[model samples]
Target: MQRAVIPLKGELTVGDDYTAGDFFDSVSFRGVQLASDDNMLPDSLKGFAPVVRGIAKSNAQITIKQNGYTIYQTYVSPGAFEISDIYSTSSSGDLLVEIKEADGSVNSYSVPFSSVPLLQRQGRIKYAVTLAKYRTNSNEQQESKFAQATLQWGGPWGTTWYGGGQYAEYYRAAMFGLGFNLGDFGAISFDVTQAKSTLADQSEHKGQSYRFLYAKTLNQLGTNFQLMGYRYSTSGFYTLSDTMYKHMDGYEFNDGDDEDTPMWSRYYNLFYTKRGKLQVNISQQLSEYGSFYLSGSQQTYWHTDQQDRLLQFGYNTQIKDLSLGISWNYSKSRGQPDADQVFALNFSLPLNLLLSRSNDSYTSKKNYAWMTSNTSIDNEGHTTQNLGLTETLLDDGNLSYSVQQGYNSEGKTANGSASMDYKGVFADARVGYNYSDNGSQQQLNYALSGSLVAHSQGITLGQSLGETNVLIAAPGAENTRVANSTGLKTDWRGYTVVPYATSYRENRIALDAASLKRNVDLENAVVNVVPTKGALVLAEFNAHAGARVLMKTSKQGISLRFGAIATLDGVQTNSGIIDDDGSLYMAGLPAKGTITVRWGEAPDQICHISYELTEQQINSAITRMDAICR
Candidate 1:
């Protein structure tokens, strides 16, 4: 993500050194941070996002509003379209969508939206405020400045009160809601929004929308209602996005219109107004038999006999080393005469389960391989079947490959595909190829992904970065593998990056002691850090590099007493205590060095000894030597 920093009450200035790239998906002003209440958290932690589905009769402009605030708006071509990237404004409000066609007609619909329980601890409050220009993905639409704000407070009696508002030049809206934590009964919220919009055509519209959301989990019965909700709206409602461009220029068709116009273009004038919508999502556990889930949504419109619907059901189970799953999907668009349906079945088994235990090597390889099969039948009764074998290679399982062969009964064609993936220390890569016998068609594709970190110490390459990361600094410890990471290690400079560190949480980073060289020793092997969002924290390890030695020494023809202290003249960490046999064991030592031995403060009790190690001995795990203190 990229953001422009704009001062709210001071002059804004920028430096001459500016850079730009296409690495980010979106851009906004820094002051707009309040627009996303959960900006500090990664997308994965934000929980489920609602998906809005619609059927556009013609080239149209789509607008999505939640709790009276416009969240997303864009242009789409005629056909069935699903908007799954909407950044939700709240956890429990329903979404209102308006489709404005090229011929000046409009269709409105509602999408139920909710998340996990919206209960908050007592006496807690959360709020946000945003002031910025209205932004959209459509280039032809005019922009407007707007302000939005929201507040949520935990009240007495296990209740919560939440409200928010949006204001623009020609549009204004407000919403209020109350949520209840019913203890063992579950959690529920009810909200209502009022909106007023003045169109470019000097027309004013006002309407009200009501929404209800509920979430519950029954641990004993193994049932979870992730989200269930319903919403209803009046016919005169108009969102900020709708009012701004309602009367803007639109395409018109005539007898002299271009002959190349698509078939859907002629129906651009049809309009359907939304009335009510219902959404449900539930999952159940079947103990040892497996689990199943059902999710679906339905929408009804005013002044129209047609309704839009989507439903899905799935079940999964496992027996010993075998896994099985069955699923079905159904969908019907508003203006379509026929609905689409599909059913699928899939299963997988470990290849090693059928192998004999006699051949250890072969059996070990088979343990990483699995046989899988899938069959599906679509609405048109076309059946397709595929069988595949997938296996993980390499001792670390960083490399994996899959091969599949399939048949489609509709075309009586045989198809095959192969894919390979490699997760290396520096990057991740994938390559795939597919071919069909029907038309001798073939296609190939490949991708490479990784991240780079630049610090004062130097630059290092690593696996794909996450929202937070840690830079490992262990000087002189080259090629030392990191613990608990796939194919990750320090570079020649003893510097590497640990990507995907969790923000606002303690993360433990450790080096693989077993992978270290004998000449290198780590003063500390593990480090813990709690990083903030988008931070690259530093983890430092003190590493000493040299030879390890175990030398037997004597002072003036007499063995040095036990408990005597020995230290190398030039090495800071090369120190040891003499053992009973007068053997001193020390690491991080040079090939040739002078040692000092002291058993007491008396003048004759201390002595100096000189030692030199052969090349072979210097390279050994533990060099052994004999020295005499002069």
Candidate 2:
């Protein structure tokens, strides 16, 4: 336990420094006359802060490491302080003190303490922001970009503020968006302001917008619940051709070009859930046998007006699981995109609704043969939902599923499947057919045929790296982008690391031979080459011999560099991190194989390389290309 040791005696003095926390935090000097040996407390300092007006007792400074972050340094000034509040993030840290004389010299010590979650009494705050590299195609380079920034606080309830932007190449062109919420009243977490945006050249549908999520749990784990809301303006998702406009009310960045931004407009929503058997979620439910979820949306615009609704429910109560889910929707326009509106509904369940891990609290782990399983169903049916069910019979617990589907209008549908996850291996596959009322559409579906671990190998690069995970800007949920530099190996396919918070496979970039480089001063730290892709004579790996690698370009003449990086081990799930510029300079031999290299122009140019491993050295000439690919 901590005891307040304020009020000391003796000619009190300090070198213009001696913070309240500096003194009170010291156990040995608890009762010592805090004569700063000559400085006096300023009138501006009082109350929670250590002050000296009609007072006595001096103090020393202290240091602490709650969890693992060190939160102390020498140099104190009397001011408001709290000891127990340091660990108000999750309950686990230490409290300590230090002492310094009138001189510049310093000394300090620590007192251990338990961790604590965010405490309302302490007024502590915890939050994270991410900036992502947004793209729209298989090509690694992004021509246009969209971003989101979110700030959340902790308390009895919580509060959040978020904003987004879509940069079309360089201009903050045409766009549109919206914002709103619902939750514990006054608990800002639920009822705060939110805005999704659409701007110039960008109307409602084709332009860029985003979704807002509200849940009860901080980590969104265990028996949890949440409320979800999204804004999908009817704008052209994006534009490829010039669009003329005659505004209903021409405004700056306005999407008066209804047809251009014509999308299923504004939608308001509510959701709820529970994890265990007999789980409950807003308008949806799930049980030990299986699970189900519900979702609905609508849209409105100038030239056209339409409304659609869907209520889907499903569960797996048996093996060859007899599960079912249904959906319904309708649409109508005045004279085909001129004016007027209409509404309708259709209900049916798909053949089988393949599953995924529902991030909602209403989802839970269930005992299968030997392992455990949790499932979530994709409700991306806002544009078009189908009536059918999809099933899976797994051997291990590894499999992928896919299917094609559609409803109303000229829309096409698709579904994918994954199966049998067991003993570290499983079977994953998918199948889909395009359903179009007009013409034969394309079916761009994919499925994994082999077994591979969901876990990724480590990224080991020697020191000389920048402070890892720095928020260059607030975009998506990723705060940092990690690189995989597993030494100079032929088989090592290096990949650009995204913030760990990202769904890796879904929205990530690949490192290659045409766009990787090392900083001029920091030879060990890999840098990225913009324009992501362009054929250049990049520094490919050498054979099992002394290889002088060079990444030459048709534009910048020629340059050469060598050395690979390795992934570091020991990173936890929720722990925040920053990269260490540990060991930078080292000379290593290049190996056999096509060493992929990257060379590009400013801004967009980035890199992916491995820190040559120190623990292992055999002049490894033929190494695993895992450093370049996975």
Task: Report RMSD (Å) for each prediction in the order shown.
Answer: 8.4, 28.0
The C-alpha stretches of model 2 lying farther than 4 A from their native spots are 1-150, 155-293, 302-304, 307-630
lDDT of 1 by residue, 1-630 (tens): 433222221112121110100000111222343332243444443436666655443335898865334568986533345588774334444465777743345555555555654555577655555566654433333467766666767899999888878788988888888889998989998888899877767777788878787889999999998888887888766555565453443432333435454323123111355678888988899999999878788978767878877777888899978998887767765655677666777788987655436546755431378897877777798777778888877656788898877777877877767889988888999998777655387779799999988899988998899767999999878899899887789999899889989765788999988888878878789999887656799999878678888778887677889999988896655577999998988777677788898889998888898888778877889878787987
lDDT of 1: 0.69
Q: In candidate 2, what residue range of length 10 has the lowest lDDT sum?
A: 49-58
Candidate 1: misplaced stretches above 4 Å? Answer: 1-31, 35-113, 200-202, 244-271, 353-367, 550-585, 594-611, 624-630
Residue lDDT tens for model 2, 121-200: 12322222112232222111222333222222222333223222223232333222222223432111212122232333
Instruction: Provide the lDDT at 1 for model 2.
Output: 15
Listed in order, each prediction's TM-score against the native is 0.77, 0.25
Compared with the true structure, the alpha-carbon lDDT of candidate 2 equals: 0.24
